[model samples]
Target: MNGMKIQITAELLDGLVLAILKQDDYYGYALTQRVQSVIDISESTMYPVLRRLKKNGDLTTYDQPFQGRNRRYYQLTAAGEQRLQEILRLWEQYKDNLDQIFYQRGEQQ
Candidate 1:
């Protein structure tokens, strides 16, 4: 499992970004760090996801001054919240199906 590569799809990436933004707004670097903490992803991979979400109208951005520089912050829109809900619903269904298979196998053996 240590060396196994789990592919993170774009949909999952979008959901993760939206979910993080659902809690509170975050600057680009901070958001990347948060997502990276959960899974192995590069900053290069993260920026495109952010761009896509923003293009899809699921996210909005603003700039705030920090340390004499403006840091761009991302916030979830109403649409983003809706997207997150849908993703959560789908994820639950997928998890449940996998759980059934795993647990049922355990019970059979």
Candidate 2:
């Protein structure tokens, strides 16, 4: 993972957020951390993504009383689930295409 930076597009970020939320609900910080676990991103970056997803009706939020204040948790809507499926399918195809080019060359070595 050293010196390797993978570019994250808006579509990829949306797909990652949706995929993470599909596993379970998470607060903004936790969600940001979860994404950071896989890819390097800041809370600043994630908050906008969350807002966009919610604005698009792909995600919904609920407030939960935790510690002292209300913690906002994000969950996927039905539309989000549909989007996840579509993104996953597209990602698989994209990966296959990339592999055909990248991996084929590796085979010769």
Candidate 3:
């Protein structure tokens, strides 16, 4: 089966990251892996997003000892959760609008 490749916008990335963190905290590498399971994204691409979210106060990070090294884990802050909800709402509306147009066109075929 083939899939249509779509661009992952900043809002989409931010929403996905927040949703993942809502389930549980994750380190940079682990978060990238989780996201990769669903969409294709490079490590370099993910790092800047994580940094921006943290800088925006939407996410918080803590270092934990693991395998004799400190791994930074990202958790969703209250603001992050709120932002996720807002993004989700907007995404739903956008998807609905597109679906209406696409589904109507498909039905005409």
Candidate 4:
């Protein structure tokens, strides 16, 4: 699987970001790092997603002074929570469907 590229859709990206924020607020860099730890994505790809989520009212931001500089943190809004729940439900259904196909096919073979 080395060097294999996995394409992550925008819906999944949004869900991942929202899920992370659900745990705690994070600055842009930290958020991008956290997401990259799980999925291969560049900061350039992440910022626009953050902007879209914020624009959609699914997230909010705040600036906290850190070492004389303000660190902007992204937090999940109530709407974000709802959206996360919807995403999770859909993910579960999708996973289950794939699992059934994969496992059942193997068992039949």
Best by TM-score: 2
Q: Lowest-scoring 10 consecutive residues by lDDT in candidate 1?
A: 100-109
Identify the superior model by lDDT, candidate 3 or candidate 4: 4
Q: What local lDDT score does residue 28 receive in model 2, on the 0 to 100 scale?
A: 95
Could you give candidate 4's per-residue lDDT for residues 1-109 as a string of tens digits? 2688878889999999999999999999999999998999999999999999999999999999999999999999999999999999999988888898978843565
Tens digit per residue, CA lDDT, model 3, 1-98: 14888888899999999999999999999999999998888999999999999999999999999999999999999999999999999999999888
Which pairs clash (backbone N, Cα, C closer than 3 Å) in model 3?
none
Q: How many backbone collisions does model 2 have?
A: 0
Better of 2 and 3 by TM-score: 2
Instruction: For candidate 2, write residues 1-109 as lDDT tens digits.
Output: 4698989889999999999999999999999999999998888999999999999999999999999999999999999999999999999988988997977843554
Q: Please name the candidate that would achieve the greatest lDDT relative to the true structure.
A: 4
- Ordered list by lDDT, greatest first: 4, 3, 2, 1
Q: Report the lDDT tens digits of candidate 1 across residue range 1-109.
A: 2688888888888889999999999999999999988889999999989988999999999999999999999999999999999999998987888898978843564
In Å, residue 97's CA in model 2 sits off its true spot by 0.3
Judging by lDDT, tell me the better candidate of 1 and 4.
4
**What pairs collide in candidate 2?**
none
Model 1 root mean square deviation, Cα atoms: 2.4
In candidate 2, where is summed lDDT lowest over 10 consecutive residues?
100-109
